[model samples]
Target chain A: MTRRWIRWLPAIAVPAVIAAGVLIVPLSANAAVDLPAKTPQQVLEMVATTSVDAFSGTVVQTADLGLPELPQIGQTAGSGSNAPGTDSGQTASIAAALEFLTGTHTARVFVDGPTKTRLQVMDSLAERDLVHNGSNVWLYDSAKNAATRVTLPQGDATVPNDGSTTIQTPAEMADRLLASVGPSTTVTVGDNTRVAGRPVYDLVLTPKSADTLVGSVSIGVDSETGLPLQVLVRARGQQSPAFRIAFSDVTLTAPSAGLFDFTPPAGATVTQQALPQSNSATGHATMPAAPPTVTGTGWDTVVSLPAGQGTSTMLDSPMLAQVTTSVSGGRLLSTSLLNVYLSQDGRVFAGAVPLSVLQSAATGR
Target chain B: MLGALAAIPVLIAIAVRVTSGSSSGRGPAFLDQITQNGLFVALTAMVVSTPLFLPLTVGVVAGDTISGEASHGTLRYLLAAPAGRVRLLVVKFVGAAVFCLSAAGSVVLAGILIGAILFPVGPVTLLSGDTVGPVESIGRLALVASYVAVSLLGLSAIGLFISTLTDVPVGAMAATVVLAVTAQVLGALPQLDWLHPWLFTNYWLGFADLLRQPIAWDSFGSNAVLQLGYIVVFGALAYSRFTTKDVLS
Candidate 1:
């Protein structure tokens, strides 16, 4: 009996060893990082003057915006429609937008120089790629077997502002947030942390006013490269971050030039598009009937859209009705950090504030 | 057994050939691509078989390892023939592992053969929407087969342990297959989200990562580690049970 028991020892001992290793490995990897301290101004300067570029990385974006989960109506419904004013088209667009704001998405980003960049959004059993090689830009969606090609005018360096390229990297998001820093924001240096296995300094930004739903925003700047590796935004009273975009893995070396060169494969529906003229040249033609207007400033800013931009049709969407509650003025779509109020008059007011604030804005009080 | 496994892709290729084309995104992943590039037949077959057929066959072969010998009253004779108990166990486990590899290999080989005959063979479009030449596509398919084979190692180890627990071969086979199905069912339940990463079946379909432009090896690495854990634990369990139990037959 003793011999039999001895033979069975490995079954218990092996699993115990594995369990302990799993617990200890992560703890050791997260051992407190130590880095030389820098003031907020120095870090801001570091971000503003950083010259490092031409890198490849895998980015992960996760959002827990406190929105109810909607049924996954496949990409077909949204991609098939071109008219944004029609009922199905509006509903499909809203559902697609909400879908983008809810789930965790992984994208591979490859950049070489200023003009050659590729973003590949990895989806389950499908993929979407936007490749910009100098003046040539190609957008390919595997699920739809569709490709769109755009040739930029000579000497134009900017990629076409198509809706397909909305998923931005941490660097892009951090640049936009840093541009808004002023007296209304309190910028401070937090503890040194590690992101994507590299030492980084955490620069924390907090809104001074309590009126804004945003509690704080933290940016992880790589110590060696001064590039923003991660951006985390927390909503007031929320323990976890409301939205996070970070590079899970990054390599500083430039990606191969072949990655930027894209050709629409056979059987794909390829559409050749001419780049839209610059906004300064044709600003009025591209503007909506009544362009959205902004009120307030800093984090409490509210964007109001007039009655004719399909706000009423969006409210009529069954998918939208499922998530929004009927408020006194109209329907209110509320998230952890953002609120949208659709007034009975078909005007829409949206802000990173409470529904009451959106209501007041909608009433033009 | 490999012939039976090989017939699956053959049947699929013929079916798709007869139908001329499958609507994209409607059926098994890569099913629509089979008509365009013959290489997709292998990928489609692997995806369809990974969930059920592969595991079922693996369970049968692995579960019959020791129990079938014991049930036939040959295990005691073999032991008395100077083949040490541990050596016999290791040999049996290795035999089952080889079956796992050949099973995946046969499906891929038959798929390519039948697909080449039935459809136009040319550049293959990866899941990332990038196209690769026929040679690279075949190489990717091989990697996918290897991934699927590695995925089954854990299940084979579990089946071997279950086989050691019983003298009835059929009972062991049934129990092993049932456990595989149970793991998959539990994995599908969102309520047990925390238990997902531990399940062996969690990454069975993750071979699609190999089809991406810049292959995502994260799933492959995680799946290997998870399977290695299962192998070590279950191999130890099978060792303890097989060595401790008396050969009464």
Candidate 2:
């Protein structure tokens, strides 16, 4: 019996070794040893100085804003009247924005220099491609088979100033988070790791303010390339991430020029428009736009938009009153990621923190 | 049986192309990626087969490994040939695992051949939206196929254990299949979610992470660990039971 058991050892040993080889080692084999180390400040400085001429990759974004069960944003757009307790267009836009922020989406992003960028958000069996080639920008919606082309005025037009298009990427979010890292944030360096097989270092920024719900944000920057790999945002009192966007794969080669060229598909509707030009030449700074004022610094930063621009009348709307609860001197609408304060004095305050932060900013606290 | 089973992926690929223009509800996670390149045919083949067809084929083959010989009265002859009971059991388990790989491999091979001819074969747009060359895509497909084959290790071991108990091959086969389905059913229950990580099928779909741009290793790594755990435990149980059991045949 002992001899029989000994014969069986080879079978067990071989498979055991094979299993261990395939299952165990490779999981942690991602990062190589003998990599250089850098402080968080150095990493950030390196990231800020590095410039990417052109590249393309896939990005996945997930947002968990502590939102309640919302109606499917896709089918709810024009069909809002079909559902009770749904305001037609106003609430739908907010719901759409919320839906856009929350769920996981796979987007194909191509950047050929800063001036030429293309982003295509993939949907089931369809896609939406946003192509900006110099002064000519095209937004192609395959679901609707509609393409909108906007021509920029000469060289100085920021034609794609629309909020939704610009803030969709992890790199863009990293820029915003890093820009906010001044006196209000405590920056530290994390351990070295790998992203897309490139050595990367994590720069962690923690907000010193206690009034906000934001805990900290960690940015993964490729050590050699200085490109941002991932961005993770965790709210206060939560161990898990509240929002994250990262590349599952990436290539740093310059994209082909033809990728930026856009032509509307056959039988697709096309709309053309011209954007207002930025006038440093005009000398008046154009329309005398009211600057966005921030009342608090760092994590508790509450940004208030100028009041009495038809926004005050929006506060009295029945739909707005139905969804929001009357706070101290304002109507408060809260979601997991953002809090909006509509003060009775016609001020609009928004932040990722809390309603109190927004209220304080409204009251100039 | 293997030949017939291998043809399923090719047939599914044809069916997918036939219904490409029509809505088939939500088919899989990366339908756009699949539609972009025919190479993903192998991925779609494996994805569709893992939950039911592949496991079913695995159960039948593994279930027959020992019981078929016993039912045919060849088990005693084989053992009398100086092949110890333990050695014979090990060989049977290894044979079953090879069949699992070949069965899935045949699907992949057929998918590549048929898919290359039918659909546009080019750089695959990964789930992460990064484009990988055809050769690299093939490598990823090989990885996916192998990972899938490895994922069935637990089921194969369990089936082998069931084979040792019964002399009827069909009964053992049916029992193994039922157990797989039962594990899946239990895994699906929200109340029994705690049992999901322990279930062999829990990480079957974890291969999706492999297609990410940077390749998320956590889920796929956990899958292998869990499957390895199942293999060790069930393999030991099979060894213990077969060693002291009476062989009337």
Candidate 3:
């Protein structure tokens, strides 16, 4: 009996060894690292002054806005509806935009300077690529079998912000968050950690006021390169991050030059466009009507759109009605970090504040 | 068995030819592309069969490895000969692994040949909207087959271990197939998110990464590592049981 049991020893030992290795490897990789200490101001100055560019990495964005899960009635209900009028059309477009904000998205980013860049959003069995090389920009969608070419004016190399490209890297998101680091925010260094296998300093920004929905923002600044590798936003009283964008893998080396060159494949519907001169400089021409007026400043700011901006038609849609609840004055769409109030009139109010604040702002207007 | 696997792509291609209608984005992922490019026929067939058909066939073959010989009253004679128990176990595993490879190969080969006969063949458009010549596309198809072959190896090991425990070949086959289905069911449950990564079926559809413009090797590498771990753990278990068990039949 003893000899027979010895024959089965390998079976028991092998699995135990593998389970131990699996548990230990990740713990060792995430072990605490000691880096050169730097104050919050010094880290902010490092991020502002660093000029390391021309790198390639893969970025993943995840959002958990605490929105109710909508049933899968059909793709037509969420996508472009065949209904003729602008009422269903605008509602369909808003529904489509909300789809991007709910799911996890993975995109490969390649930048070879300010002029040459490429972003490939990888979906399930499909891809959408935006290639910017010099004055030429190509947007290709494999599922639709369509390609669009936009020609920028001479000496203009920046990607046109047409609101279609909602995916952003950690660096771009950090820039937007850092702009709000004035008197209303308190900045401090939380911990020294590792991101994308590199040492990083966690710069935490906490809002001084309690009115804003945002609790705090944490940025992972690469210790050596000063590039922001990750940005995490947490809503008040939420344990998990409300929104997160981070580099899963990254390298500082410049990508291959051939990656920037894009020619529309045969059998694809191609459309040619030119970037408007005025829109190219400002980069915020998403709305056709006048820009919404701001009510307050800093985190408590509320944006109010005037009447006749098509807010009533969107609120009337059955799909939007499922997510929004009726408030005292209008329908209210509330999320963990943002709120929108659509009044009985065509006026609309939106902010990152609470629902009560948005309701008060609407009544005050 | 490979003949049946090859017939899948042929039937799919002929049906598309007869219907002569666009897929309208219904059915499997690449089913809609089959009308425009014949090469998509192979991809669609692979995607359709991966979840159930491939696993079922692999389970039958692997589950019959040891039990079939015992049920036929040939195990005692074979061991009575010069063949050692350890060498016989290794041979059975190698036989099952070969079947996994041929099963994937037949589907891909039939897809390419039928697609060429039915539609106009040209440069293949990848998932990234970039076009590659015929040579590179064939190379990519081969890699996809190998990735699928690797994906099934873990299930084969599980089936082989189960075969050593029973004298009835049918029971072994059914049990193996049940385990595969159970793993897939557990993988689909969102509440069991922590257990999803450990399932063997998690990366079965990851071969689509091979079709990208600059192929992503992350899934391929991860799948290979996970399968190798399964093989080591179960191969030892099978060895322990097969060597210690008596061949009274």
Candidate 3 stretches with Cα past 4 Å from truth are A68-92, A155-165, A274-288, B21-24, B244-247
- Which residue pairs in candidate 2 collide? A65-A336, A248-B213, A248-B214, A249-B213, A249-B214
User: Interface RMSD of every candidate?
Assistant: 2.5, 8.6, 3.0
- Which stretches of candidate 1 lie above 4 Å from their native place? A70-89, A161-165, A277-288, B189-193, B247-249
Candidate 3 C-alpha lDDT tens digits along B44-99:
88997888888999999999989989999988888998989888888999999999
Alpha-carbon error at A221 in model 3, in Å?
1.1
Question: Which residue pairs overlap in candidate 3's backbone?
Answer: none
Model 2 agreement with the true structure over B117-171: per-residue lDDT tens digits:
7788887755433457899889888887888888888899999988988889999
Fraction of native Cα-Cα interface contacts (under 8 Å, chains A and B) also present in model 1? 0.58
Write candidate 2's Cα lDDT for A1-365 as tens digits.
88667645654775577667766766765545446777777898888987876788878876666554344334323322323233344444344445565555667788878788888765433456688898898876544445778787677535463323333566777887887678988999877776656677888888887777778888889787788888988888776688888886787898778778776643356877555532221211211257767766767767787776446656766655765788899788776556888888777888877776676566663
TM-score of 3: 0.91
> If the candidates were sorted by their lDDT against the true structure, best first, what order would they fall in?
1, 3, 2
Per-residue alpha-carbon lDDT of model 1 for A12-42, expressed as tens digits?
Answer: 8998999999899888767888888899999
How accurate locally is residue A49 in candidate 2, as Cα lDDT from 0 to 100? 86
In candidate 2, stretches whose alpha carbon ends up further than 4 angstroms from where it belongs are A1-41, A51-112, A115-170, A188-202, A246-298, A303-337, A340-349, A358-365, B1-50, B71-73, B84-154, B161-249
Q: Model 3 over residues A34-79: C-alpha lDDT tens digits?
A: 9989999999998998687889988999887888643323433333
lDDT of 2 at A58: 76
| Clash pairs, model 1 backbone | none
Give the per-residue lDDT of model 1 (tens digit) for B66-182. Answer: 999999999899899887888998999999999999999999999999989888899988766688999998998999899999999999999999999989999999999999999
Report RMSD for candidate 2. Answer: 8.1
True contacts kept of 2: 0.00
